[model samples]
Target chain A: MVSMLALLITVPMLTAVIAAVCRGRFCRLLLLSGSILHLGLALYCFNTRIDGRWIGLTSYSEAILLVLTSGLYFAVCCYCCSWLKAEECSKKSLWILGICLPLFLATMTLVILSRNFGVMWVAIEATTLFSAPLILFHRSGRALEAMWKYLLICSVGIGLALLGTLFLAFAARMGGVELHDLRISEFLNIKESLNPGWFKVAFVLALAGYGTKMGLVPFHTWLPDAHSEAPGAVSALLSAGLLNCSFLGVIRFAALAPDKVGEFCTELLIILGVLSLATAAFFIIRQGDFKRMLAYSSIEHMGIASILFAVCGIEMTMIHLVAHSAIKMSLFLLAGNLLLACGTRQISRISGLFGVMPANAILFLAGVILICGVPPSPLFFTELVLLCQAPLWLALLMVLLLFMVFAGMMKNVLSMTMGKKCELEIHAAPAERLIWVPIAGLCAALAVGIVFGVNL
Target chain B: MNMAIDLVLTAFLGICLMLSASSRLVHCIRLVALQGILLGVLPLLMWNWSKACPGAEIWGAAFVNIMVKGVLLPILLIRAMRKAGVKRELEPLAGYSWSLLIVSVASALALWLSRSLTIPGVSVLAIPAAAVTVFTGLFIIVSRRKAITQSLGFLAFENGIALFGAAMHLEYGFFVELGILLDVLVLVFVMGIAVFQISREFEHIDADRLNLLTDTGEVK
Candidate 1:
């Protein structure tokens, strides 16, 4: 089973290498085959646990990650088919996508299976290394800057995570255990005996460190730059997939901490999460750049996840993670379609997308509604659960945050989809509808889960 | 003996700060190199007083730290600087004086915070030294305009962390040493590539100029 977990990581990574070296149309086929194989492997892990060793990779969480990543990876693959249609002189950006796509997926898999904290840190850092080049795939001045901010900020964040790992190592040291032995269960088993002060310090550092990657506010400065400037597929992975993996790292640490310390940690997460949501809400309301607006939405979703985790609302968190992944993937992929049609991501210049690219417009409309947590959406249910469990004050705060996101995001997204068409012509092919299939599927699944209470 | 080693590290860490505040990029790089050399010998200095019985392990760890963190990484960084053809700190996003002030404050906080928890493996000197190293690295990462200098800051940050861990008596010295070594080498090379890419695109490697992708949040 451990070997299977290892295979889950290696297969995509190795495939990425092969895909990077492969030429022409073969790159897309190779990437698709690799993603499909990954989805299958994830399903195998979902169905049967290897003696129930890993928590998130076992039973329900494994299924959630698999379904979410598969949906996300599929959207990315589809986007690659269109998004990377290079001009004769244009460098084959597909090779870069091929190399990073699997590596990105593999890193997320590693994060889920990582029982050892040290291994988890390595995986988180690996995500940065794999994705940095992808962010710069366009090789534009904007892409270069975004890549730099992404690398510098994330490296420092991960560096602090390393410090926290060392602190946790220190905590383990006083317990007279090997640093490798600092597993969640092992830490929890010895939680009370370990130094409370040191444990608190470790948890704070880990939260800030991993929180940076998760795109929580204050530490989230790198997020907008990276997300807005990267190719749509990379943006989708950053939003729908990568953030959750880092959240899992924090969750792993939180699970091990004692109740009191857990409260302290959650308090910090909740504060950061709420701040991130509020910050995104403000930015999204007035944000001119469509891609940058979506970047802010990513921050909001991350904040929502952090808040749920803080309340110890695990079911809500899982639903939100899955729902946000699906909805955000739909939104980013549609944004890509818009980019192709309009050749600009500036919201002020883009209007009446519904008329210009009707298929994308409809998908974007659905995605916007779903993101706003309207009725029958999975996020609506998850948000409901979060409100119920939250303290009265927090419930009020969440309502305000949700309303801000709804209003702000609705203003921009609605204007983009509903306003009068500009002079630009939409050159979308009939095959572009395939990209909408996953969005429709996710929306339908979410609707069924909401109404029928399908234990998804 | 531990105190003595701590004092030595503290002095080197001070040199690192002075170098960080220096406006000259080459001087900053050189100071980082000196600090790396000092970090290389830190484990040996700290372990000399330990009653814990050991032979080549401590020395071996020190040798690796010196060779990897001290010598190899600095040389690579210097080469990157030369290749990029950037000298002197360009107009930093954050001012030099403020960056220095923040570093000092973070160092004080690290020192004060160190006293709060009495973890067994950490020595008095190791905590402040590590804290100073981390703070200086952060300042460099945040304030420096050039990608290379920011990376140099990161190297110093790692040096602090490595020294802290060395003090902690993590048993697998060889593995930790190798991990840190590989981490620095790989990260530096990756960072070097990013600098080259930045220069190729922008004709300069200043991070502040790269903020072209802001959310259109100005409420017009």
Candidate 2:
């Protein structure tokens, strides 16, 4: 089991090195195989308990997240194979992608698997570094702009999170607890001894720091630009994989707060969640670019997940996270297909997508429906549970915000899909048949919505 | 020994003030390097005064911190500046006079904050130094126009945290400290590359000009 955990991280790092040095074709093969092995190892760890001295799976929730991250990574890896083949990328750019993508996966895996708060913080910061290049893969002026915003804003935010971690250590010391290392399990064991005042400060800072990474409101200014400018596969991973890892950072820190301070943390989450939802709704309603609209929707869903976690606990948050990952990944990937077909991300410029590319259009429509919490979608069940647990007014606000999002998304979908065909020629390569990838993703989301909806 | 630590801390605070009041990019980078050297020496000074022989791990962490923070990062930033052909910040968001005033206000607030937000078992000056450094770093990031200068602000912010860790006697193993150093190194390296790209594409690293992506307008 320990060996599996070690393999889970090292395989990607090794693959990344090889990809960086090797030619492009071999690099793609290496990435695909490494991701497949990672997914297999993640699945194997589900039933097996692996506890290392410093890094191990501490809870079922973490295990679930690890699996979710790996699953999304595997899917993205597969899609990248087709994406690379289709796009007329330079050899150097392809090599960079080959290197950075696996490195990004490795860092995220370390984030999920590490039990030490310090290690988790390092891994999260490393993810920022590794993923920045992916955002700049296109080398456009706009992509550079997006990459700069992502690197600087997320770095400053993560820097605050480092300060918060130190505060947590300081809080522990102030409470007369002697900790050998900054371990989450150790902190929780002595939670009663932690100074609540300092703990609250740490909580707020960590939330703001990691919350920025999670694309929560106030710090979410970087999200729309980065996601829209990045290639489709990268956007999918940022929304589906990276956000969850950062939220895990928040969850780990929030768990260390004392019961009284935990209430404060919950309130903070709810407030940020509502604000994020409203902010996303406002931008999403008037968003001109399809990819940027998806980015805002990511903020909205992350907000809902935070609110759900506060009200309904980890189980509901996990369910919503999984469902949202699948749905969002599919939407972004399909959006990628649309961009490929029409050579533009502008919603108004795109028309009669259904006639031009029926497979991508259907997938996009299904993703929209699932994302907005239509019946039988797992998000719908999560929303129902949230409404039941939350206060009346807050629940009503959530419903109204979600309705606004749904209407806005439907309007875009109808406009993009049902209008007369534009004169823009479809750049359909042999690799264009990979629309089935997102269709498979949609099926996976539907499966989770049904399976978890019933069991939970 | 206490007087020596106090002198170094005062010097650190003085550099923070200089950072805010200076507009020359080279001067700011040098100030950050000097600040990093002071941060590197802090733990050793504390260990010597307390007569506590920290294990090999502390020595290793101190060495890496000094090398990465004091020497390597500034070198990276300087090379990036040369490549981008940016010499100095022309129009800062806050003028030097305003920045100095804000820094003074921040220092006053930090002193008050240090008294109120006391943690047990840490040096009295730790919180104050951390607070002032953090505020100065944030101010630089917010006030500077050049992307390279903002990167320097991030380094200063990180250095402040390193000082806090030292002040609190928090020995977060050599591996974790090394990981932190490596993270900062990579972050600065990546930011340098990004700044290069921004300048190459736009012919300027002024962050204000990175306004192509907006909500209502059609994306270019």
Candidate 3:
């Protein structure tokens, strides 16, 4: 019980190490085994409860959702086995990823379990480091650029967070609680004792800093570039897993700030969220590159997730997070398959995916339905709940952005799926059918979520 | 009271500014070395002049600072400079004279700002030096074009942070300090890779050229 979260974090990390040492075909088998183990542990973690003096992990529902999300992860891992047949990427690169992937998972788990602000900051920074190699996995010109941008921007943003941490320390000292005796509970206990002025600054900095990682507008400049360039498996982990963990960091601070300050901050988040959606819609409509379009879509969903957290209740935010994960992962993996079959990432260059790879084509269409928040999809219900809870003005704006994004994504996905058959034929992987299983399962989960039917 | 040592230590602030403002690469490197040496001497002077208790840990910290900041880091930096073969800061975004003027103003502002803040139980004199060190580090990072200089700027930034930490009398315990040290080492190694990669790719290490990879979605 004491080590449940630790186990969840460590298992994948350890598996990554072993997988790295095992080369070629053995690596895929190792990854497959690791993913299954990870999924099971995530389920067990959800069922088990652990309490410590400063931390607790008794949220069974979140754990279950987290486990299901691991299904998408495992599926991507399977796809990666064949997708990354490039001989240039060495065994050492895989080793680094193997080590870093688990470390990344462990850090995310740490972020989830940590009730302390300082400890959580460290965990978040650790995530940044672990995810760096993952982003730079391909080591191409574009990948290098993306990794550099991710590092420099995140380091600068996280540096500001460090400044905020210092401010909190000062606030504690001001309240007659010296820095040495500081803890999360101390601040909560003496919430009134903290200098509200410094507290406000700290909260704002933390929000903007961590929100940068969450891919909110303005701080989201690196998102499309990073996501598009990274491998599909990495992209899925990023969109479905990492961003959720970052939001948790922001929510931690939002949970701390009192009334008007919290409201004001949440309002800022909502505006950024809306702007992110609007921005994604604008770009996705005209985006030539399919991967880039998917990248923008992820940003739009992140924005929606942020706004939902800001406006709606926790249940709405939590449900949306899970829905977004399933749909987004399926969407990205399907896109990866298309890229594999077409031999190009250009949207206009290739068409009639349905004829070439019918399974992926259908999966892509369903993913589009799910992402657009169409009925019977969880995102549709979550979007509805968010609109219901938000002010009418904000709701209208959100709905407009939602429609624009939906239209943009629909146009892209439809044209790519059902357009005229290519004059030239492209060979696709025989194993491509495996990608459908995860997509179908995710769609089923989405169906259940939309109905709010599951008692678990 | 070691007032002379205090004055010399504070003079390192001006030297850091001059380094940031300089167009000549070798000269900037020298200035950085000087600043590092000046920062290394700081703990000793503080120990000598401090009316309060000076423990063995403080002395140990001073020795480590001197060794790492004063002698070792600069030597590593010089080796990197020779390896990179970047002689002058070619195509600096901010001109040397303007950079110098801005650094002067920043130093003055930092002094004024530090004086304004009422940090209880701190020597008011120490705060200005710390603040200036911080701003100078910022100036170096912002003004310089070369990755190596920017790295030196980052080191100076840490110096400023260390100085501020000292002024605030905040103890981060040994583990946190060790973690910080490890992070800095990794930072240097990664930055070295960045420098080597930049040089290999473009045949020059100007950060302005590195801006070729911006998010404008334009042709390279």
Candidate 4:
């Protein structure tokens, strides 16, 4: 079991080194095989209970995150195989991608599996460094700007999180808890002894720090720019995989707070969640770019999941996370397809997608339906559970904000799909196999929704 | 020993204030390096190393912290600044005079806040210094126009956090400290590359000019 947990992190890191040194066709093959192996290991860990001394699945939340991360990586890797074929990037950039992508995955895996606050902080910070190049994959002026904002903002944010971790350590020391290391288990064992005042401060700072990475409101300034500017596969990972890893940091910190501080933490999460939703809704209504619109939707869904996390517990949040990742990954890949076909990201310029590229259009619309929580979608069930658990006023606001998001998304998606053909020639090849990636994602989302729905 | 720690922290706070008031990128980078050195020395002063020659773990952490934070990172920023061909921040969102005033006020507030929230097993002076440094770092990042300066601000912010960690006598594993140092080194390196690319493509690393990816309109 320990070896399995160790292999889960080492495989991608080892493959990243190999991919970085190797050149040409072998790089892509290495990435694909590494991702497949990662997926297999993730499945094995999921089926079996693997607990280790330093890192293991200590909670169901961690387990769910592991599975979601690996599943999305597999889907993105499969998509990248086809996407890389179409890419015209320089060999240097491809090499950077080959090296960074697996390293990015490795860091996230480490983040999920590690049981220590200090280790988790390092892994989360590493994610920022590894993924920065991926955002700059296009090497455009705009991409450069996005990468700058992402690196600076997230670094500062994560730096603050490090301070928060130190405060947690100090709080433990002040509480008379003898500890050898800053492990989560060590803190939890002596959680009652922790100074409540210091614990509150640590929790707030950690939330701000991880919340910035999670793309919650105010700290979410970096999200839209980085998401829109990055390549489609990278954006999918940012939304689907990276965001969840940061949220895991928040969850771990929240768990360590005392009862009173925990209430304060919940209130903070609720307020940030609502603010993020409202902010995303305002932007989604005015968003001109399709990819930027999806970015805002990510903020909205993360906001809703955060509210669920505070209100219901990890169970609902996990369900929302899995469902959102599946649907969002599919939507992002479909966006990539549209970009390839239309050659422009402007919603105003895109028209008659249904006629030009039927496969992407149908899948995109389906993704929208699922994301907006229309019916039978897992998000709908998750949101319903959220509404039931939330206070009346908060639930009303949530429903209202969700309605605005739904309407905004439908307006953009409908106009793009329903209008007369635009001027650009459709270059979308019949990548029927590529279309299956999102199909598989959608099916998985539906399966989780149905299974969870029945259990509920 | 207490007096020595106090002196180091006082100098750290002075540098934080200077950072906010300075407009030159080179000066800011140097100030950050100085702060990093002080932070590296802090653990040695705080811990009771006199009882025994400190283990390789403690000495190694101090060495890496000084090397990476003090020496390596600032050099990276200096090279980036040289390449970007910018020196002073011509225009800042918050003027240097006001930034100075803000930092002064923030330092006072930090001292007061630290006094109010006392945690056992933590250095009193270190807390206020850390708070002031953090505020100034954030102020620099927010007010500065040059991309390189912003990165420098982030470095200062990180240095402040490191000081706080050291002040608390929190004995993180050597590997964790080394991991943090490497992460910061990589962060600065990446930011340097980005600064160069931004200057090359847009002909300036002024963050104000990076208005291409706005929500107000479509690029196409």
**Residue pairs with backbone overlap in model 1:** A287-B216, A288-B216
TM-score against truth, every candidate: 0.90, 0.98, 0.86, 0.97
Could you tell me the lDDT of residue A333 within candidate 3?
Answer: 69
- Badly placed stretches (over 4 Å) of model 4 are A47-53, A430-433, B112-123
TM-score leaderboard ranking: 2, 4, 1, 3
What tens-digit string does per-residue lDDT give for candidate 2 at B123-200?
667778877898899888889988898899988888888787787787677788889889999999999888888888
User: Where does model 1 exceed 4 Å of error?
Assistant: A23-25, A50-59, A86-89, A172-180, A430-434, A437-441, A444-448, A451-456, B1-4, B21-24, B37-40, B44-67, B90-122, B170-181, B217-220
Model 2 / residue A376 / CA error / Å: 1.7
In candidate 3, which residue ranges exceed 4 Å CA deviation?
A: A16-26, A47-73, A85-89, A179-182, A423-425, A437-441, A444-448, A451-456, B1-12, B23-87, B125-144, B147-166, B170-174, B210-220
> In candidate 3, what are the lDDT values of residues A317-391, reduced to their tens digit?
887787787777777766666665665677777678888778777777887877788877878887887888889
Shift in Å, residue A158, candidate 2? 0.7
Q: RMSD of each candidate?
A: 3.5, 1.4, 4.0, 1.7
Cα lDDT of model 4 by residue, A345-431, tens digit: 899888888887788888899899889997688899989989998999999999999999999999999999988988877786743
Query: What CAPRI grade goes to candidate 3?
Result: acceptable
Worst 10 residues of 3 chain A by lDDT: A53-62
For residues B122-149, could you state the per-residue lDDT of candidate 4 as single tens digits? 5677789988888888888888888888
- Candidate 4 chain A — worst ten consecutive residues by lDDT sum? A425-434
Candidate 2: RMSD over Cα atoms? 1.4
Q: Quick one: ranking by DockQ, best first?
A: 4, 2, 1, 3
Candidate 1 at B191: error in angstroms? 2.1
